[model samples]
Target: MSEHSYIAGIPLVLGGNVFGWTAKGDGAFAVLDAFYEAGGRMIDTADVYSAWVPGHEGGESEAVIGEWMESRSVRNDMRIHTKTGMLGGAELYEPARVLHSLDASLERLRSDTIDLYYAHKDYPELEIGQIVEAFDGAVQSGKVIALGASNFDAARLGAALDAANATGATPFTALQNEYNLVNREAYGPDLQALAQSRGIAMLPFFGLASGYLTGKYRTEEDFAKSMRGGRAQQLAGGKGPQVLEVMDAVATETGASLSAIALAWLVRQPGIPAPIASARTVDQLNELLEFTQVELSDDQLARLTAAA
Candidate 1:
């Protein structure tokens, strides 16, 4: 099996959760266009996106991406990564179910092969062998180029890797987890150590702490800036404001936007190959794109890490 390595140039992975839900079709197309025009290539989405929205059956984001790829005709220049196994209709780790889900994703993305396919989350109930067999089967079928895990803890991830080694199945090459200056517990020492030891690329979701670290939501009233305000609300207390304070200081020192600083910090973190962040508008995307060039100094990183 070919090992999937990390790509440079654009360090941000555009999140597609808002494609058909908040941005709708046209707005999503505009955002995607701006992203690609700015040299952004990696996009992250999932089959279960926007399912929490009322009257939505999911796969809405992938469908929008498919249409966008059709309209833009630049699929060759871009890398698309998506996830399965999170939709609520049924459990997804079963081999038959995993194959069926991937087929559906391919149809929606209008792509023959997914550049990276993630098992949306770990399923401890399913035997480790079962997960490996399912992913190995997908790689063999050419429906997925590589496999990854999202929301996996260190211990479970280790077990999964052991299973892959013993069975000689397709191994996970990447990881997706909630990580940022504010949300650090999930991907802290344990996960960081495991990924570094295994050489698995880390793609941290919520790289901006759901926009809290973006400096757009300073006060409680600023939470109305987006529908995902509840997430920001969670960061308002405790060390959230403290983390933002350090980010603000670093942004000021480096003359970078808070959003850019937040993402740049993730890029500097050990084991992180890229960060998965989202933008609902072209302006928001522009701020995130700044991460491509802004390099955080060791001192700035130290301050942010110490604060967090």
Candidate 2:
């Protein structure tokens, strides 16, 4: 069985990638305040978050989150999830490396224990037993409550589970895949089935397709709205416009914004506990938090599923 109960009611995981990158300091704090005020419980970040930015060496986002927690005095109220792979100059998925990376995460988050820790990317060549043992060591140290795997395929996830079972470590309780209206194939069939069979909670990243599903970017002009515009063009490719049309219809039918409806669909999926989405401002957060209260109907869901 899973070891974490971090996300139960909230329909979304407030993505922490924007902290210290797009929403630094007070701006990030405001977004966090908005999220908790609206009943959000889980905040997802990583040790390597925003490390791709110039002059950043990673852990910047986690530091901001720790500061927010200290400032707000609600550390116990929210579940903190952070990843350990692909940060700084570290290699991926080595057992000894996992120890060092998580220690760094602990210091940055200023927490004795993380509610959930994920291997940011799966390393296929590594022995599953070794990986599972590494995570179990964290749990043994009382530094992590549960461990998760992101960016892994069905076969690898199955192997990880077997290793965890053999080593008697905390099994993976959650999954973070690139799942959204535009990006479906990555986590479509095999991963979905495996997660369901193992009862692992699904937490999809790129939940809004990098803000494409928000209905704000429909043309070349809209691309200028974000520095991530070039990446957003993938959504504007084949059938992108058609998907937007369906989303628009659903928005009209449900009286929900396109972003909310999109997230509601993920929440309504079989294994998904919450969809991970980031907001750079309180205004954006308000729109995302609304998904906690919004429910999409069967027809609306069908429309989206088919269109997507």
With candidate 1 superimposed using the best TM-score fit, by how many Å does residue 262's alpha carbon deviate from the native? 0.3
For residues 179-284, write the lDDT of model 2, one tens digit per residue.
8887787687888888888988889998988888888888888898778776777755686788899998877777889888889888877688788999999999
Each prediction's whole-model lDDT (CA) = 0.84, 0.83
Model 2: CA > 4 A from native: 1-3, 88-92
Model 2: how far residue 77 lies from native, Å: 0.9
TM-score of 2: 0.95
